[model samples]
Target: MNHSLDGQVAIVTGAARGIGLGIARKLKADGARVAIWDLDVAGCDAQRLGFEADHLQPVDVASYESVERAFGATVEALGRVDILVNNAGINGPVVPSWEYPVDAWQRVLAVDLNSVFYCCRVAIPHMRARGGGRIVNVASIAGKEGVQYISAYSAAKAGVIAFTKSAAKELARDNVLINCVAPAMVETELFREMSDQHIEASKAKIPMGRFLQVDEVGSMVSWIASPACSFTTGFTFDLTGGRATY
Candidate 1:
């Protein structure tokens, strides 16, 4: 139960705000040197949140060059990356699949799915050299069970879940544990993109009948990112408020 990350270094993408920010906060509290990788560093409040001022790295997760460059900078500043949280994502639109914008769909997949791969592709080598590490991709319940109208979001998360599993198997012998959390809904700024009707309907599906709290998700990631989460790799830990019976 000791989710201590003492002496560890963690990189959390999409951390300018919302769930990613919460995860960064938790990691810092648990003793890890945390880096916030996002488009805008100022919005993440790294200093105010008690994170090292030098740990902020501006990055566009959707771009491979940007992610790679930031990774190098993070290493230069924080030394090494021992943990990676692929939490960057977007809920493109509420329209039906038939009516979705091609550009929007592509953008959603790029940020939500491709970026995870991009970051992992870069982090895995370093982790192997260090003999072990943790990678936690923030998935969603929609990935497990396809929702009614949010096709792009659901598909992207599902890919994240699958990628976590595949990548874990490849790194298991090396001791790099990789996993994901399939959350139903977390109250964050991302909610601004969701329609009220979509939010209520999604909440109704959860047996808990409420939106998840960002810190709750953050706590889960903290445990998964720590040495305490050994013996589990390429797995999906449910955080759907009793909604994920599987």
Candidate 2:
């Protein structure tokens, strides 16, 4: 497939590292001007070393004002936004629903779900004016199937899946496409930060017997955000390494 994104601009949140970084790099390689937004202002500089000018910003997806301000700043810097990848999220804690922390639970939902809404709410208008745009959200397999623990993350991701569908339907008339990817376990710094026993257990559950690569997820995201992904909208593409049968 010819996945060239020439003359396009993409916004990727949580791009200081890991999957978000991978997606930004892929978009740049495909000729799109990329703007990376993350809360880690310090880390972003190191990651922005060789990228083109005016493409990094400190965006706190969990805050409405922050998101709006960041988006505004990004537009001033990158011209327009043609693609948005709502990838900023957190796995709050491994706990049952009954034991979930109120604060942590809300934080997870705010970032994982509300962030998607915030970006779409802000970017859709620009996209409509540009004639069309694409949105590819980073969901998780936990959203599809309830895991033993981590109820907060599972619930938050599930909301992302549903939001993608509903938003796609509303935006389709405007030629904006919204889709999501549900990856089971991926090899990212996020995973490495987890406990070794937990990581091993998660890997053991995957039929592929190994964690998915960040680039693999990036490739899927790039396709969903590209003009090549015309027919599919409000859909979930699996990247569970054979762990998901549905």
Tens-digit per-residue lDDT, 1-246, candidate 2: 668899888999988788888888888888888888889757555435345524778888988899999999999987889999999988888767898889988998999989989988898888999899999999999999977678888888999999989988888888999999999878877875567777888889899788889889889998888878888999999998888878
lDDT (tens digit, per residue) of candidate 1 on 17-125 = 8899889889988898888888888755635665654388889999999999999999998889999999988899999999999999999999999999999999999
Clashing pairs in 2: none
Candidate 1 error regions (>4 Å): 46-54
Task: Provide the lowest-lDDT 10-residue window in model 2.
Answer: 45-54
Write down the lDDT of every candidate, Cα atoms only: 0.91, 0.86
Model 2 accuracy (lDDT, Cα): 0.86
Error of 2 at 184 (Å): 1.3
lDDT of 2 at 140: 95
Instruction: Name the candidate that leads on lDDT.
Output: 1
